[model samples]
Target chain A: MKNFMALISGILFSLGLGLSGMMDPKKVLGFLDVTRTWDPSLAFVMGGALVITVVTFRFILKRKAPVCEQNFALPTAKDITSRLVIGSALFGIGWGLAGLCPGPAIANIFTGNVQMILFVAIMVVSMIITEKLVD
Target chain B: MTISSEFTPLLSLSGGIVIGLATTLFLLFLGKIAGISGIVRGLLTGKKQDRSWRSFFIGGMVLGGLLISFLKPELTAKVYEFDTFKLIAAALFVGVGTTLGSGCTSGHGICGLSRFSKRSIVATITFMAFGMLTVFVMGA
Candidate 1:
């Protein structure tokens, strides 16, 4: 049941990406391109997402415990450390250059976009390399 | 036809509503948080017990996009444009960064921060900062 739900959610997210023009690298790039033909559409998307999150999470957390699980696994660490900064910088760089983040990148698969496939492949390899290096 | 000025906002609201509904439904039905980072992590970790939920979560995201596209063909046009090399490089960088950060934007920015997580706050700030800096450097 959990797996099924997760899969469903992923599909929904991908569908949303496709529908919103997020799967198209050009759209993403346009959003990032503040100087030329800047598209603030992504901001609206983020804003919409933020509003939903604010309202729903407020109620969900009040339940004392999650419905299907014992408790929400929250991250405990808190510090403006080097790892956080470096990691974020890397992620940002990737976003600016590629114009596709992880969520939309995966979602792009449905579009049969060859560039997205190549990007995903490189991402996977990078993940492996990073894991090994850090280990 | 020229792009509707209202299209982005409308799509964003609708998308948000769908995501909210989906997250709520998943939590109520499956007892889970709709954190993509956690789902992807579980999928990769090979925890048999965790696999099913992770798969479902991922599937839902994909299905959501497909369903929307089918219903709204006009909205399915590609938005962003980038070279293949740049995209691949960016993907690789993000993969490394997410792994190091221990979570993605969805996990930290969306879910974590909502729960008043300090870690997430820090993560979000860092993510935004880096994002800004990257764009500045890339001149995109």
Candidate 2:
């Protein structure tokens, strides 16, 4: 049951990425391009998502715990440390340059976008490299 | 609402609804948060017991695209440009950053903060702040 739900959820998420124009790198780049050819559509996507999430989460939290999970696996740390700052900086830089985040990048695969594949390849390779270095 | 553009509000609304439904269903049926970060992390770390969730989660993401493609072939085929070197660098950096932060935007920003997690709050703020700054520096 858990696996089935996970599969369905991923499909839904990818569909959202497709419909929201997030799967298109040009649309994402347009959002980044504030001065020229600036597209505010991505903002709508974000706003729409925020609206749904805010309302839905409110109802969800009313429950003592989640229906399927034993408990919510919440984060426990709360420090504005150097690691946090540096990591965010890196993520922002990547998003700005590639116009693709992990979620969208993966979704782009269905489009058979060559650039997305390249991006995903690098993303996976980078993940491997970083893991080795950190260990 | 009279639709003016190919990208209609209804498309977004329905898309969001699908996303919300998927997330809720995953939580209720899978006993898991629909967080890409956790799934990917577990897969990479060789958490054998956790592989099922990760595989199913990723499979769902891919399948979602396929389904959408069937409905809107034209929209799915839109072209976009890419710079290989920059993208590679960016992915590497994000990989490193996510590792250090112990979560990505989905995990920390979405799921964690939704639960009023202090760590997620800090991580999400950090993510946004740096994203703003990066855009500023890159002149994007």
Candidate 3:
């Protein structure tokens, strides 16, 4: 049941990503390129999502546990470490360059785009390498 | 700055709402944040018992993208092109960065920020700033 819910959630999330033009690297880059004909569409996407979350998340979290789960697997770390800032900064540079993040990149895996395929492959390898180094 | 000609406020907003709904469902039912990066990482490094749901969720995303491509081919179409070296560089940065940071756009930007997490807020701001800066520096 939990897996099914996850499946449903993933589908819905991807559908939203697709419908919102978030799947396209160009669109994402367009949003990041603030100096030249900035695309505010990404902002709207965040805004719209936030509107829903901001309103309902509080109530949802108020419960002792989720309907189908025993506990919320929430993030425990609260520190603003250099790891967070530097890591995000690096991610931003990559995002600006490729306009592909994890979600859209994964979704585009089956699109038969060789670039995307390579990108995802390299990204996965990098993740593994980072993990080994960090651990 | 001039607005891009391709801006679609309604479509993007509606899409966002859909994303919001998905995350909400994820939290409400599974008691987990619908963070793509965290999910992927969990799939990679988490315990054995936790793998199935992550796989299912990821599979669902891939399937959903495939479904959308069939229904609306234009949505998933690649508009811009990047060189091979650049793509590799970008991918490396993203992979390492997301791992170190513990989230990405979905996890930190949406889920984390929505939850009013200080870590997420900082991560989001840092990424956004750097993203814009990179675009500016690269002149892309």
The C-alpha lDDT values of all candidates are 0.64, 0.65, 0.88
For all predicted structures, in order, the TM-scores are: 0.83, 0.82, 0.96
At residue B118, give the lDDT of candidate 2. Answer: 73
Q: Which ten residues in a row have the lowest lDDT in candidate 3 chain B?
A: B73-82
Instruction: List ranges where model 1 is wrong by over 4 Å.
Output: B1-7, B27-33, B68-81, B136-140
Candidate 2 lDDT score relative to the true structure: 0.65
lDDT per residue, candidate 2, B1-140, as tens digits? 11122334566555555565666666555545566655676677756877887887887787776676677654553355455677677777777777666666566655665566676777777765665455545544
Q: Model 3: which docking level applies?
A: medium
Candidate 3 local Cα displacement, residue A95, angstroms: 0.4
Candidate 2 per-residue lDDT, tens place, A1-135, comes to 767767777888888777877666556555656555556666555455556666667677666676657775544566767876676667766767666667777766656567667776777666666667776
Give the C-alpha miss distance for residue B13 in model 1, angstroms. 2.6
Worst ten in a row by lDDT for model 2 chain B: B1-10
lDDT of 3: 0.88
* Top-scoring candidate (TM-score): 3
TM-score of chain B of each: 0.78, 0.78, 0.92
- Residue-level error in angstroms, candidate 1, position B30: 4.7
lDDT by residue for model 3 (B65-139), tens: 888888886777444466778899999999999999989999999999899999999999999999999888875
